[model samples]
Target: MDVNFSKQGDWTIIAVEGRMDTVSAPEFEKMVQERILQGSNRLIVDFSKLDYISSAGLRSILVAGKNSKAKGGELACCGLQGVVKKVFDVSGFHKLLPIFDSKEDVLNRE
Candidate 1:
């Protein structure tokens, strides 16, 4: 998997692409960790280009979400569809985090 990062105001947007499995989970985790260490609070994880995600990916997301929330910030997942959305649904993330239909919806809410 590959992660492309950008910023808009106080929010850090991470556009993730490829399969987020066991092998790529660490990379994703590292990117998130770096952002957190840099004192970034608002995190918008854009999954529009993501094709697949395993449980390991979920773990990374869980950690990131927890950290972001603990720091008095917010973390949201945007642009999910197909089986990728199914995984999140089955995994109960739809209930855990603020999952938005699009980037516009996410930005508008903020």
Candidate 2:
């Protein structure tokens, strides 16, 4: 998996590509941890190009979301589809996390 970082206002956007499996989940978690340590609280994870995600990936996302909430910020995900979306829904993460249809939707949220 490949992860890219960008910013808009106070929000840090993470665009992920490829498969987020056990091998890449740890890297993803580390990147988010580093960003949080650098004082980034608001986070948007873009999964438009993500083809697959394992349970480990979900766990990493859970950690990031919890971290964001603990800091009084927010973490949202966008562009989930197909198997990835199904996994999230079946795992009940759709209720646990804020999900949007697009990055613009997340940015525009109040």
Candidate 3:
């Protein structure tokens, strides 16, 4: 998987592409952890280009969410589609995390 970082107002946007599986999940989690440690607590994960995500990937996201919450900030996701969306829905993560149809929706809502 490939991860790109950007910024929008106070939010840090993480755009992930390719597949987020066992091999890439730790890297992704580390990246998020680094950002959080750098004081970027308001995070938006963009999964529009993501094609697949394994349970490890989901665990990474859950970690990020918990970390963000612990810091008194928030973590959200957007642009979910295909299998990624299905995984989130099936795993009950759709309700666990704040997910939006797009980044704009997340920005506007929060």
Top candidate (lDDT): 3
Q: Which sections of candidate 2 miss by over 4 Å?
A: none
The alpha-carbon deviation from the true structure for residue 99 of candidate 3, after best TM-score superposition, in angstroms, is: 0.8
- Candidate 1 Cα lDDT to native: 0.90
- Superposition error at 102 for model 3 (Å): 0.3
Candidate 2 residue-wise lDDT, 1-110, digit = tens: 99999999899999999999999999999999899988998999999999999999999999999998899888999999999999999999999999999999988875
TM-score of predicted structure 2: 0.97
lDDT of 3 by residue, 1-110 (tens): 99999999999999999999999999999999999999999999999999999999999999999999999999999999999999999999999998999999998984
Q: After superposition, how far is residue 103 of candidate 1 from its true place, in Å?
A: 1.7
For residues 1-110, write the lDDT of model 1, one tens digit per residue. Answer: 98998988888998999899999998889889889888997999999999999999999999999988888998999989888899999999999999988767877884
- For model 1, the superposed segments whose C-alpha errors exceed 4 Å read none
Candidate 3, residue 35: Cα displacement in angstroms equals 0.5
TM-score of each: 0.96, 0.97, 0.98
